[model samples]
Target: MTETITRTTGSADVRGLSRWTAAVILPIGPAAVALLRYFLPYDTVDDSSTMTSKVMAEPGRMSLVLWLGFIALLTLVPAAYSVGRMTRRRAPLLTAIAMFLVVPGYLALPWLAGTDQLLWSGTEAGLDANTITRLAETPHPTVAVAGVFFVLGHVLGTILLGMAMWRSKVVARWAAVAVIVSQPIHFVAAVIIPNHTLDLIGWGLQAVGFAVVGWAILRLRNDDWDLPAVA
Candidate 1:
């Protein structure tokens, strides 16, 4: 009977992880690809396309992608809290809230991506003189919406991630601190530099988060935190 229980629990762990992989981890890479398309180093920002005008042109659905991509970060930091909790006695509510935020945010991501395609297509095709002026006259409403949400999700997520570090102590206290501190470092940069390097940060951070989350999850699997099955 003990052996049977162990086997059953093991099976459950595998299943739970599989679901997590689909819902959270798997989407990170693809979503990043979708987001970086417009923001990368050499990405086109037409001389003709002013800050406001450029954003207004297409605005079809890229925000969805960016949002989803940002959602990965949202999921990532909380995931750290979850990891830290593995070794801690106190439960981490921040991580749980972060996890819960993932679904709605992710669901909204693809639509934003679509909007991007539409907006870009308009820009690449070139707008009429009047259209260009209109684009620049005031901030495009959609751009503001996307930008605010993107920043909010990420900045908050990083804080949550840092807190997880404080809680988990897995990557060592200093390293965890660095992870959390990186957010503020980058944020300061946004003000100092020509623009936010959020895309770059997103790309770079994804690889790191992937490795960290994978390691933590592996450890969880070994320990059978949920006690799914005995291995």
Candidate 2:
């Protein structure tokens, strides 16, 4: 019986630690991305050569931006996982589906970031911008597929996770709504309108939403944050 109680206590401790870790990390990725957008403000509609030129013009700033982007990508999966954990009890299926979508989507980001490095290297080598652009834009079918997955996964997955959070009632309705609407705004700002200010605002909303959620999690007792272990 003593061993059994010890096992139960250990389980509870692990669960509590997991919840705390998740809450602490949830806002990091989006906040980093928002900062990146604010600092870099790269024009998405520019051709590869133009974009490369812009990066070359400010190599120091570009390096910072790249690091920020890397941080955002690194933390995204954990942020998504936190959302899944928050909603799982009340909206298991939705959380499951969102995780399925976001894991692959977030994982694909590093692959896409390779373009930035390639462009920077090409410029440093004094390669023709047009030639570098052509090489970068080479129609690799695998990359094309990953791009599709990345787009659909992040946008759709985030929306679904927000819905799950709403259904769970773990966070305020406004916070959940903020999370839900953020991605659509990001999509429009980054793709359709290509406004850096709007992109910053969009990612800012996500950061705000996750910040609130993290606060709520912090306020919960360990037992409330996760199921108590039964001896």
Candidate 3:
């Protein structure tokens, strides 16, 4: 009986730790990604050749930015999962749908990162900007599909998740609204206007939104965060 109790306690402890860790990293991922966008060395023109030239000009800084983005992508997975878990009880279907979109969307990071890596390699090989741009622009069917998934998944999924959180009342209404509006603003700032400052603000809203969620999670009892193991 003692052994059984100990085993159950250990399981509960592990579960609690997992949820707490997720809570801690939730805000961090979005914040890091937001900073990555703000500090990106690429030009605002959306021209591959211009971007390549800028990256080549500051290879070290660009590399660091890329790595920061990679790490942010890694962290976002758990952050999404934790949000889903928090809102699931009240909005199970929405959480499910959001996770379905978000998981693949964030997972497609490698496909996006491949372009940056390709540019870096071309620069290192002393290729001309136009040549590198040509290679980067060469479309692959698989990459094209992944790009679609990445865009739809992150943008739509985040909005859905925010709606779920709002319905569930897991986070403050303002925070939920922030999450819902963040991606659309980011899209406009990144694509429509291409203003890095606006881009930062867009993603910064998401970071703030998630930060509030993290605080809510931190306030929960371990049993509430993750159910205690049955004995």
Candidate 4:
């Protein structure tokens, strides 16, 4: 008879992917937020504007690109690893579905922001223009173009995220709920109000999401405990 092995390998694998996702993906939102907030200001077109398209263009675009890339990569990563970790345990396909949704949602962020960025690129000042100039020059982004994703992705994604975290308890349950609630707030603003309305709320909510996930990854880093082997 062959010796059978039942270890936390499945959990371990998902855990690894989760850690990787947390390290790379979680930081993306905050990184973009920080970069824009600190370096790029609100895009002034004044001659006094020091930053140029060449400067902010690369960093800003790269942030969106990399963030989306990570999100896409993670969609495949988590779904594959989750099938095994969650098999016969709980969540079943929901785990994979939730994991996969992250990609589309991420892609949506750049798509929505693309118009503004492209237009800004045409000018000497990309993201360093004065608020009034930027508002007057740029078209007030369309509904279908950028609004939908901003509403659905963040809102639904947050709900699924809360469920995922709650189901797995990878991070504390309440922390997941905290992230979940922000989605509606983001979605409502995107759907009805102006984008600027969500500036602080969106950033603050995302900050919480990152903090919780990052903390979970750090705690699990040294863990090698196997679920099956425990008993």
Candidate 5:
């Protein structure tokens, strides 16, 4: 009886942790990133010609942003795990596939960010512009392959995961739809407005969607905990 009670308590703890992770931390990464991209100091051309000089001008601020970005990427693991868990009961295969894609996609984000930071730091250390440009333009074949994986994983995985969540009915239907359409809407708005308005829409959608998911988790009864384990 004691052993059974202990096991039950452990399972409950896991469920609680997973729920909080999904509802709270999951949304922070994308929202923070969107804010960073749109905000002052960190704001600039996506791949500007003057990157070296920019890095030299504000090395401290750039370094802080880089570390913050890394922290944001770290939140993806728990977010993905909770998402997989919530959808597994209704769409096991889809959830598993989404996890496979998204895990690598998020993992690659920090690596890419870190790589960029290192290049900029190197420039600050008097590295030649030609060498930096060449390196950025011609990444290793493996890095290039990883970049492809990163892009596909995020784009395709989010769609699949959002659909799975919709089918699972784990969150509000509108919230699921918001998650599904956020990226495309953001992309379109970015090209059209080319301003912070895109960031507001992009991050707002994510915040609302994740908040709904979290609210739903908070409402879960003990009976709901009998669902399939997250693979």
Candidate 6:
């Protein structure tokens, strides 16, 4: 009886975790991402010199970017995991692929971007302009590879996950649409807007997608909590 109770408790914990991840962490990540983008210094990507200058000009403001990014990164792991759990039964293969891609991709960019910026913010006084320029301009191959994965994860993974959710019929159809449409919408907003004015909109839409997904997960009436059987 004790053994059976322990097994049941473990299963309940897993279900609870999935629900918490989907409902809370997932939505929080996108909102944090939006806040990070909105607070970033202007034209940090313009050039090496411009990037260095901006970092030095406002270290305090730049520091906020790193903090926000850290929060986003923290939430992304569970968000991705919840996506996997939600889709595993209906679309196992695709969901597996999405998790494989998104886990690393989503984690890498934020950590790398945050580290890259923090280096400048933390030690502007000790570092020289030439050093800063070199650090800023030098291309790290690892970062390039990570960027590819990150793009694939967000673009492809999100779309696949959205499709899986739709096909599963566990969530409202419009929720799937929100998750699917957010990426391209963000891309278009980035292209059309100046000074990243639409960044809030883009990120806001992503948060909405997660929020809708969270709600859908909460509404799941399955005895299994819609979780796939783990071997």
How far residue 223's Cα lies from its native spot in candidate 1, in Å, is 5.4
Looking at model 6, report the run of 10 residues with the lowest lDDT sum.
3-12
Weakest 10 consecutive residues of candidate 1 by summed lDDT = 40-49
Question: Candidates sorted by TM-score, descending order?
Answer: 3, 2, 6, 5, 1, 4
Write model 3 residue lDDT over 1-231, tens digit each, in one string.
355442364342576677678778888878877887788888445678788888889887778778888888879999998899899999999999999998899898778878888888888889998999999889577788888898999899999999998999998899999999988988887778887788888888988988888888888888788766665
Ranked by lDDT from best down, the candidates are 3, 2, 6, 5, 4, 1
Clashes of each: 28, 0, 0, 9, 0, 0
Query: Where is model 4 more than 4 Å wrong at Cα?
Result: 1-21, 30-90, 125-151, 195-198, 221-231
lDDT of 5 by residue, 1-231 (tens): 353222333233465555555678767766666655554243333453355556656677677667667766877667767777778989998898988997888787755675567666776778776666556665556676677777677667877888888989999899888777766665555544556567567756765676677677767763475443332
Measured against the true structure, the TM-scores of the candidates, in listed sequence, are 0.55, 0.87, 0.90, 0.52, 0.76, 0.79
lDDT, model 4: 0.48
Instruction: Return whichever of 2 and 5 wins on lDDT.
Output: 2
Winner on TM-score (2 vs 5):
2
**Candidate 1 per-residue lDDT over residues 68-153, each given as its tens digit:** 45655445443433444443444367556544443334344444454444445445566564564454444447654655554555
Q: Rate the local accuracy (lDDT) of all candidates.
A: 0.47, 0.81, 0.85, 0.48, 0.67, 0.70
In terms of lDDT, model 3 sits at 0.85
Worst 10 residues of 4 by lDDT: 79-88
Stretches > 4 Å off in candidate 3: 1-12, 43-45
Model 4 lDDT, residue 182, Cα? 58
Cα RMSD (Å) per model? 6.9, 3.2, 3.2, 8.5, 4.7, 4.3
Q: Could you give candidate 6's per-residue lDDT for residues 121-156 as a string of tens digits?
A: 545556866677776667667877777887788777
lDDT of 2 by residue, 98-153 (tens): 88997899888777777776776776788877877887887467777888888888
Error of 5 at 231 (Å): 22
Off by over 4 Å in 1: 1-49, 52-91, 97-115, 124-126, 129-147, 195-210, 222-231
Give me the candidate number with maximum TM-score.
Answer: 3
